[model samples]
Target: MYRLTWFATNYDVNREVNNGRGPVDFKISKGSRDKTLVEFKLASNSKLKQNLKHQVGVYQAANNTSKSIKAILHFSQTEYLRVQNVLRDLGLSGRRDVVLIDASPKASASTVSDFNQKGFDF
Candidate 1:
């Protein structure tokens, strides 16, 4: 998905890029001087705390760029709270560089009848 989005643009996106330090999830760059690292993780991951602490910094150093983004997906409310706590512990709360995605399943709009139907003409 990331690759497809950046494919048409001048940016180049690569996954699991290894630069000696270790392989990062994704690397988006237009050139050596313009590079950004993106790391994806699950909220339920066992190493979530450790990864949130030291992973991105190492990747940035290895890739020679200080710019990076961390994205974590939570499947439930509990997982979301857990991620929040972890981020708080790591002093990264409310940071724009860290993205928290809620991937929990939801009921379809058609199946949900709580909407105001007065404006519709079915």
Candidate 2:
């Protein structure tokens, strides 16, 4: 997993190798005093959402961050725009200093349309 604090003079960035099904990315803390959680997926997978939910919920609770822990889903291309949309609507888009990066411009737009048309919950 990778851990990094952004927009700071000093930060922590750690990349941990995955052993099985686990995270490989990092999330900036809601505040230096608060806790953060993150997950990175290079490919689009339906199970990613479930992982997101758990991270934002159970994981946050476990960490005891009442200020709403941050989350980042690093995708390589259109494979993850679906998740980005949900994050955007929730005001978690990169424009808001939440989202991390885009997988691909083409796939990003297509993923949005595809998700909307197929009624998939990104």
Candidate 3:
């Protein structure tokens, strides 16, 4: 969420902005310019495909901006692959505004298990 906070200094950042169609997770703008709609989702969300195809476009239109961004976080390999398919289906695979963050615990996360077995808290 550091990026979101960082964006606030130059733009008016609004949360859960409803534009008659649905709520946009974030609406960012600098005065009357550079309006950007941002939506976030878990990669496991079943409605991800549907929303990306139609809902985001409508939000951009309603917000009167041509720029929009979608951020998805994946908690597993399965979720990451599913997002790839959906991005291809929506022709957003190459779009710069669509962002995917891998949130899965890394293999390194278990490297500490050996230390834990020795009852070390640090």
Say which prediction, candidate 2 or candidate 3, comes out ahead on TM-score.
Answer: 3
Encode model 1's per-residue lDDT on 9-100: one tens digit a residue: 98888999999889999999988799999999999999999998998999999999999999999999999999999999999999999999
RMSD of each: 2.3, 11.7, 4.6
Q: Which regions of candidate 3 are displaced past 4 Å? A: 1-4, 107-122
Runs in model 2 deviating more than 4 A are 1-32, 67-77, 84-100, 105-122
The worst-scoring run of ten residues by lDDT in candidate 3 lies at 1-10
Reference-based lDDT, each prediction: 0.92, 0.48, 0.87
Residue 105 in model 2: lDDT: 38
Q: Give per-residue lDDT, candidate 2, residue 45.
A: 57
Candidate 3 per-residue lDDT, tens place, 8-122, comes to 3866888889978888999888888779888998899999999888988898888889998899999999999999999999888978999999999876755665775778776
For model 1 the local lDDT of residue 101 reads 92
